[model samples]
Target: MNSSVITPIGKILNARDLGKLVRDLREKQGATQADLANFAQTGQRFIVDLEGGKATVRFDKVLQVLNILGVELTATRRK
Candidate 1:
């Protein structure tokens, strides 16, 4: 996605925003938290925390999850 769309999410805690996005994507893809966790190579509990927006997850971890969900993060200057 473009940086403009991501900028608002970036301003907040990325974990929360990314978590919500992941949850939505997973649900849309008919994947469960456990399934996503396995795909992301993380614990299910972590996925729960992510989905709940209750953790300050690392950016790299968030990116990993997003990658697994086929969501790409991109940046571009806004004019």
Candidate 2:
């Protein structure tokens, strides 16, 4: 897995963009929603909702899902 390709998420200005990112990464890893939910210890509905850009998703669960997908979130000051 190339770190650079996964690291720069470009301009993720909203939830729909975030959802698309998750969906793309999941598909690249050959994983199903159920697989991701089980790995993240979340309900399948959560996965569905997350990928559908549900506005009220839990951040903690989002972190868990990202972890299960082998991705990490980073914070840095804007240049």
Candidate 3:
């Protein structure tokens, strides 16, 4: 993991934040977009769109990548 990359926790402010975090994590693991896509069982284009912060990508696919990267997200009541 890059030393400058701070692991995101709690609230993700938006798609771009999520994308950056994902990209950082992927790079930390030394995995290419294609490699991550294969591990997530998703298309490379999906990974591309995801890391590029394309907001309209399917939610399930996002979960897949997060799962494969060992990032856990939990839903909580917004105060």
Candidate 4:
């Protein structure tokens, strides 16, 4: 697998934050956008739009990309 360990993105306050984190992780793994899209079974356009922080992106596709990048999403009660 081309998966890399996902790092903490701290508090993500918006779509851009999530996009940046994904881009960072993908770059850290030295994987091309196309490679990630293929691994995630998505289209290159989706990857591009995602990295550009497209607000209306499908949640399932986002999860697929995150999975391919070995990113795990978690939620907790805000302190």
Q: Return the top candidate by lDDT.
A: 3
lDDT of each: 0.78, 0.88, 0.89, 0.88
Q: RMSD (Cα, Å) of candidate 1?
A: 4.9
User: Can you tell me which runs of candidate 3 are displaced by over 4 Å?
Assistant: 1-10, 77-79
Model 4 lDDT, residue 74, Cα: 83
Question: Which scores greater on lDDT, model 2 or model 3?
Answer: 3
lDDT of 4: 0.88
- By TM-score, the best candidate is 4
Candidate 2: which pairs clash?
none
**Compared with the true structure, what per-residue lDDT tens digits does model 1 show for residues 11-36?**
33455776677788899999999999
Q: Judge candidate 3 against the unseen true structure and give its global Cα lDDT, from 0 to 1.
A: 0.89
Candidate 3 residue lDDT tens string, 1-79: 6875555564677888889889999999999999999999999999999898889999999999999998878766779
Q: Flag clash pairs in model 3.
A: none
Per-residue lDDT of 1-79 in model 2, one digit per residue for the tens? Answer: 7646655766666788878889999999999999999999999999999999988899999999989887788766878
lDDT of 4 at 60: 98
Off by over 4 Å in 1: 1-15
Task: Give candidate 3's error at residue 69 in angstroms.
Answer: 0.2
Model 4 residue 75 lDDT?
A: 76
Model 1: how far residue 21 lies from native, Å: 1.2
Clashing pairs in model 4? none
